[model samples]
Target: MPSLLEVLKFLGAGVLGLTLGVEGLSWLYRRLKPAGSSRISEVLFFPCESHCMESLFSDGRVSGDQCVCGETHSTALQSSPVDPFYRMLSHLLSARVSLDICVFSFSNFELSRAVLQLHARGVRVRVITDRDYQTIQGSQIGVLRKAGICVRHELSRSVHMHHKFCIVDGRLLLSGSLNWTMTAVQSNQENVLVTDHADIVAPYLAQFRRLWEANDPARHTHSPGNADTYAPRHHGHVHKGHYADRVKGLVHRAEVEKHTASNGHVYQQ
Candidate 1:
């Protein structure tokens, strides 16, 4: 058995290491995400802003008509596809039994609004958000639970949970780079993999459970700081039956269209 002082020292060192590691990784990520011809995961559906909607909706060989996800096609404006993000939010709002969200931070207005709506609908919304930004994002926690959403903070060393994922009805999951923040939807280069596979969703569910259980008050603590001052900048193939191309075919698309450059490597724009 170790002395209490030794245990404390070890814990302190571990926390410091986690912080440094995250900062280092973030720097490297900034370097690699330049725009060029580097191939990425096949995009299925993504949000389009003002400029690309017109070009994207034009008829092409792969798609007989304009992409259905286009914002405008003819005289009348069209609706965007209900991508995974919207689908997940819709399901959450419609959930009668439960809604589980495990995100590093919970600050986006749209996302928070959806949670509140779900609460109003009598759905049990449980959230596990990062404690680092609790002071900043924490204000909404009380508001959510007051409306009936059950929210919890993950008591971990890292400033970020570093995982953006959600599971719904034990049947569907949305996981990947998209965080519950304004930039993720509006400007950042991010992608989320949505799936209906229980096997993949199981591990994430287990991780959330373990973290939630480990959140004992006496075990973790953080020093007070200006929490609101910082805005921390932060796949799969499935087979379907043959001959039923309508039900079996898959669509790939890009998530964000931002230019990035690195040591001669360019990514999608």
Candidate 2:
């Protein structure tokens, strides 16, 4: 009934129609499918085998059995410049509950301001440092003490209170060779390790507590003539009441007050 040429032409038309229909269906499927479905399907099908690989790719996006979708897959390390004063300031500012600091020296005005600000915010703060160091001309111990922040000096004069560390909110520990001073922060080469690791924090916490208890200010007596002069109590000796009068005289004469700079640092003038 049909000629050979006509039959060939009809078969060719049918084949073309079938190919076009298949192409149209493929385009519609691609359009209707959700984005990232292929990645999810690949992950589901392969499933990362190794623990590290699984952790790296656990977000359901895979590349050759590796996860590429996890945000935390890549390790991140933070570092500070040679001058870590700003970093220290940031850490101090972020404290919500308490701050414990021990250093060989602390004379930075900016650091003093940060401590005062933290105290103002109802965050408990404590400090321990070398006794002789605080007697320096620009030392901030007097300012800190005047502000009602608990400041203590090491009892032993022979051994230097050379530790430089800070604990923030009992969670983060900052320690290393850095001293809380403008010279150490701005000029000297120093490093501070800030970590929340429990292994490292626990020991430092214990050490701080020990030092804090051993150097309690109440255990010693201050001379009335000079507030900086501290003498250990003899079991049999009683201190005269004139010591209070001397302290009042010194406070009245010194007239310590908080002087703020444009940069928010508190200085004693």
Candidate 3:
């Protein structure tokens, strides 16, 4: 029968062997890993409260005060731990030419700051958010608007502009279930997908353009609840097209119905 000391020795040996085996396997995997696999993309999760992303700047590389994203890095204000949302902000700050953002909520202060920084850097920024949320307490929409950023919100009361996406440079795309709010960033579970795949990005770019045109304050002049009357926003020049013709036809039909109803006659389309 083995003594107590022998039993302890056997257990210790087994643990050391297992650890060594794992280390060897990891080394081999790294050596054999395929190239370009790491370039695929990145999917970052949120709610990382313990380790804020400020750590990424711990080496004093980039700082906002200098007005740089990949422009420069700053030293850690907190600790050397990577936070995912802040990582996302870094990517957002890298925008060079344009950023078209469409989202439901816009109350996140850090995000607002990034957008403002981009704008100050001469990046063309367009923001489309929910009409209702634009007035909510702590909303950054008003701030963006006050800064002269082009902001167009949904005019529908029943439906909302719930898209959370931003196209960067007409190439890179950022979209996901994350909301630009502190609660969503610090507590709620969220995910952000960042990709620059052309095929995938092209569609989102088109969608943004469509929404931008559709929500143009000029386009909503004739819409219900809008105070401004319908008029061409661009120097009184309306784009002549099928949509223009359709809008005119609908307005005419509505007027005819109203007049007929007042006279007790049913108007036919």
Best candidate per TM-score, number? Answer: 3
Deviating ranges (above 4 Å) for candidate 1: 1-85, 137-139, 216-269
TM-score: model 1 vs. ground truth? 0.50
Ranking by lDDT: 3, 2, 1
| Residue-level lDDT tens digits of model 3 in 18-100 | 99999999888766766434432677787866333333333344355653344223345324425577667777877899999
lDDT string for model 2 (81-178, tens) is 12234345566677999999998878877678888888988999999987656765578888998999998888654467999898999877888877
Clashing pairs in 3: 58-76, 61-72, 61-73, 62-72, 62-73, 62-74
Candidate 1 clash pair list: 34-260, 34-261, 35-260, 35-261, 35-267, 36-266, 36-267, 43-252, 43-253, 44-253
Off by over 4 Å in 2: 1-83, 221-225, 233-269
Give the better candidate number (1 or 3) by TM-score: 3
Q: What is the Cα-based TM-score of model 2?
A: 0.55
User: Would you estimate the TM-scores of all the predictions?
Assistant: 0.50, 0.55, 0.61
Q: Which regions of candidate 3 are displaced past 4 Å?
A: 1-40, 50-81, 222-269
